[model samples]
Target: MLDSNETIVAIASPTTPAMRGIVRMSGQSVVPILEAVGIKSSQAKRAQVIQSRIDLGTPLGKLDIAVSLWPTSQSYTGQPSAELHTIGSAPVLQSIVNVLTTAGARAARPGEFTMRAFLAGRLDLPQAEAVLGVIEAEQRGSLEHALNQLAGNLSRPLEQMRSEMLDLLADVEAGLDFVDEDIEFISDEALVERLSVIHAAVDKTRQSMESRGGNRSRAIVAFRGNPNAGKSHLINALVGREVAIVADVAGTTRDVVSVETTLDGHAVQWVDTAGIESRAQHDPLFEITAASQAHALRASQNADVRIWCVDACHDDLAAQRRYFETHDGSSKRSSIDIWVATKSDLIDSTQRQPDWMYTSVITGDGVDRLRDRVSQFVASHDKEEVGSIMGTAARCSGSLAHAATCIETAIRFVQQGDGHEFVASELRVAVECLGEVTGAVYTDDILDRVFGRFCIGK
Candidate 1:
């Protein structure tokens, strides 16, 4: 999938009119292509751009251009590579690409440049994926995180672990090889200790990916409650905009409405869902409303924090308890629950002041407090993840998790007095899993899935 034998050429800039654009060529024919464009020998490893117009083919007109050359192995692709800086025009770039192809260079494929780097051991699988993350960064935090990944902060530990695993596997395999002689090449005590070390490292990596690395996915904060509990109003209040429709009618919100915001540079999804009710709890098979409620419940379940709103004017404390009871705060990835007393302005001394945040949309009181609290919640939950050592990629995370599973099974095998061959086999599988995450091992299918998201010529 990563064929780097032939010289490849591509316009590396956006195909739009701009002040400048880059055209990249890599591999063996790069020198000839550079010379064909009138580059001097001293231009190697220099950023200086030589200005000139060269004859591109007979009828294709001369183009004023500048060339930056990296004539040795230190290039991005770890081979001879050059960049053509020219006026930004799609046709002009295509013409230049055509001229280069005529000079025995083929057009580069999507992500071929970075893929070449990965293939040539310039970047591992995680760092390669980080390139896409860097390109697709929606904010500063994500961009910095991508840069961290590109710097190999995540790959170093995984490589170390893989190295240790390799040594242990070798020792176990040696025992398996001499089983007929009853030779204990690696003792049960020593094997147990070694496996325990690898197991802890694998488990630590898994937990980091699950928690601190979790910000790689969207963080959802939801407003949920009984009908007309000011859920929509609260959402608008918190986001500082009227994204959700505000109304006095019961069951006004029959669907989930979302608005995105950033708190402390961390992205947040503020979700407003359909009001909770007994009918929703029933979730009748024939009802469409039940489906929307189910969706809301799922969203709430999956949210990082759920704001449960109860109106101060009404008394549904018993029903709210029942609602919280059935949901059973116990869940995998369970959301943090915040009880909120809404319509605080209408509350009189007779009304019971619930042990929760009091909010009043009419008076704009407590809205700022809510916003600040939400911001604090998001910041506290995700602040540590920004620019973390481990790069967040779902595919890589999954591989690590599966690798941990394999290691745990191997540990169990060792503890159960399993055969050296069986334990060794499990170790081999686990090593391969870790290798996939770091790109020390790869397949065409894996490469396709990893690089397919990259733009052409990246």
Candidate 2:
């Protein structure tokens, strides 16, 4: 379906200094450009040659180039395509693209190249989405998932389901047309069975689409305790950076400090909140504002894990216990509350605290153990993958929901002993809902929204 009217060109490389850069061009003009640049070759076939300088007579100077060409049928967009590999200098790359544009090629729009591939039937919507996934992926797990989708892992199952739905629809239409026929083309029992299979398949896909990795979960980890509890020091130690302001004075951390980091391939947001206190009058007016402090307290209460960072050198152990005892008890059980004693270097070698580790954020003592415990908590709560299922997009999810409603109506019609025609009408509506998911009967708006998320040069 590629339009023959326009030619597209783009710099198919990251906008950073690298060893090599490529300027890709596709359409009818590619062959003429290759021939003009002294890289003489047949326009009927694809060819590539290294270090072949294409001298373009321009105002700047004669241009030196390397060229490769793919014939119309074999090219990515089903049009004549070429790639000019040059030194990794931005100026050289820009000069070549400028020369091509002057000769007659418009700069490719964002995602236009990939969009052409989709229109040309080279890729389906899911595979097209995977192209973007491969580009933006940062983790190994995410990269594997994207690669699997690109290889048509999800598409095969979706296509099977679509085929089943189409077969059922065709049977229903045939039954309606031959109303007087005695032959049972599609029995009531068979119709119910087909609908059940379709519903089950769609439901499975919906479940798979739910969040998988630890980073997708909204759980947070908060550091809390009395003033000078080494909260700031612990934050820096965990992230291996000096992100929070560390000071010897108490109440130094009056505001919440947060940072995002990955732990065991799971994304986590670490928060350091102001120390909780009993005396309200002594606190500053800004701290007293219910909205601000309440927000922090709520976050702490809802956190997946709350580390009560305590100072090991302090002698008032019982007082600290009493202080936390007076506060609300609901949060204590819900959150994984662990007592952490910082500055283990200052404590006596013989003395030990019960159910507590000797942690020195400064010396990096027992920090690895702490990180291991956090990783364990995340892994235990993550969902397991059983049967293979496709991750549903927002549009697919909405379509499934609509189809479910239509199926419910069909079920009611069957139970009420409505005429076969009425029951068939509701089933047709159900089939349409399913069709929308696979782009069989999609609106223009749906198509635009799906493809619009892609990058221009894709």
Candidate 3:
């Protein structure tokens, strides 16, 4: 929207003292700008690299640079584009940018390059956000999620859903237009089924977005169970250090102990909570046990994943069941529930529970398996929710929720024998809502919110 016909330029590479740097330019005047800056061979460009020198004079006389050109209109921005590769000297790059600006190119705004790509249909709204995700990704998991979004993992399905909705809307409107013909465009059962599918899809997407809103920054794994169940030792083993104090005494960990580390390319916080036990209210230590229990329950409630540690040698199946039943209502349940039989080395293989992971910090029996299960659970939390649109999830959640509501309403109308006109109207609203997700119905404000976070020269 910002004068696409005019040329824009920026230094594409990091402003560091390195062996190479890049100045990127795009628009109709890319070739002319190069020619004006003394690159004569740019005029004959057809997606070729041209070697040239710029006569800066004075402090820096002539410097050699290579210019890679996409002279045709099939480039990243769907316009003529080029990049000047040279030494990664900040001053030198700034000077080259200044020279290009003086030769008829304007300095690019933040996220302007990707914004242009979005405007030119090279990338959708979700994909544009993924570009930023890739830029700001701190770990490999985040990067992979962003890369998948950029590759249309989120957009493709929404696009397909939109297409199907459009077909349904057309049929509804057609039925309304020919009401007197007594023709059935879609059966009530079929319409309800289709609408339900759309509603389910939209709801799933909305829930996924909500899940990301709470834990997008990192995953919380809480270690909890009866005192002296080896919870502290397990935490230390997983973190590869003694982050939590371990002891044979029950209730030794009277507070929440947490440590941050990377597991399977994801930022994970390991939380060790106090052992769960009951003390008489009249006991002098009642208040202490009560406070520790409260903290443990709070940590368990807040955790994204929970690992229940049971003493393999002492706790029987009945005790494990009672432990779970007593603490089930303590907090909001974790998305993943893991049972761990700790101190496995103290017992034989026949003592292991089939459904519980067995581990022993003394011998390191099932620590790696438990760690893998936690990592896999965290990674696949919302994978099916439109390919886990990591970065765009929060942004599009409202629209997706609204779309689901609209579909639900339309389905009710169809079931209640409402006129086709009403059904068509609701479907129209749902279609527009989906369009907003993919930039097919975006406003300038949405564009600003999406592209504003991008760095210049993307």
Which candidate has the highest lDDT of all?
3
Q: Would you list the C-alpha lDDT of every candidate in the order shown?
A: 0.79, 0.68, 0.84
Per residue, candidate 3 scores C-alpha lDDT tens digits across 167-224 of 9999888888888997988888998999899789888877866776545446789988
lDDT per residue for candidate 1 within 1-458, as digits (tens), equals: 54587899998998989988888989977888767765555664554556666567666677777777777788888888888888888888888888888878998888888999998889998899889877776555566667778888888999999999999999999877888896777787887788788888877877766665556445689888888989998888777779999888988888888988876677899999987764544655338677777878888877777888888776666567567658635432424677888898887756655567888988987888887777776775564344333344567778887888888888788889988788888889989989998999989988888888788888
Model 3 scores what on Cα lDDT? Answer: 0.84
Considering TM-score, which of the candidate structures 1 and 3 is the better prediction for this target? 3
Order the candidate numbers by TM-score, best to worst: 3, 1, 2
- Model 2, 231-250: lDDT tens per residue? 88887888888888888887
TM-score of every candidate? 0.62, 0.60, 0.67
Steric clash pairs (candidate 2): 110-456, 111-455, 111-456, 111-457, 215-267
Error of 2 at 109 (Å): 1.1
Model 2, residue 353: C-alpha shift (Å): 25
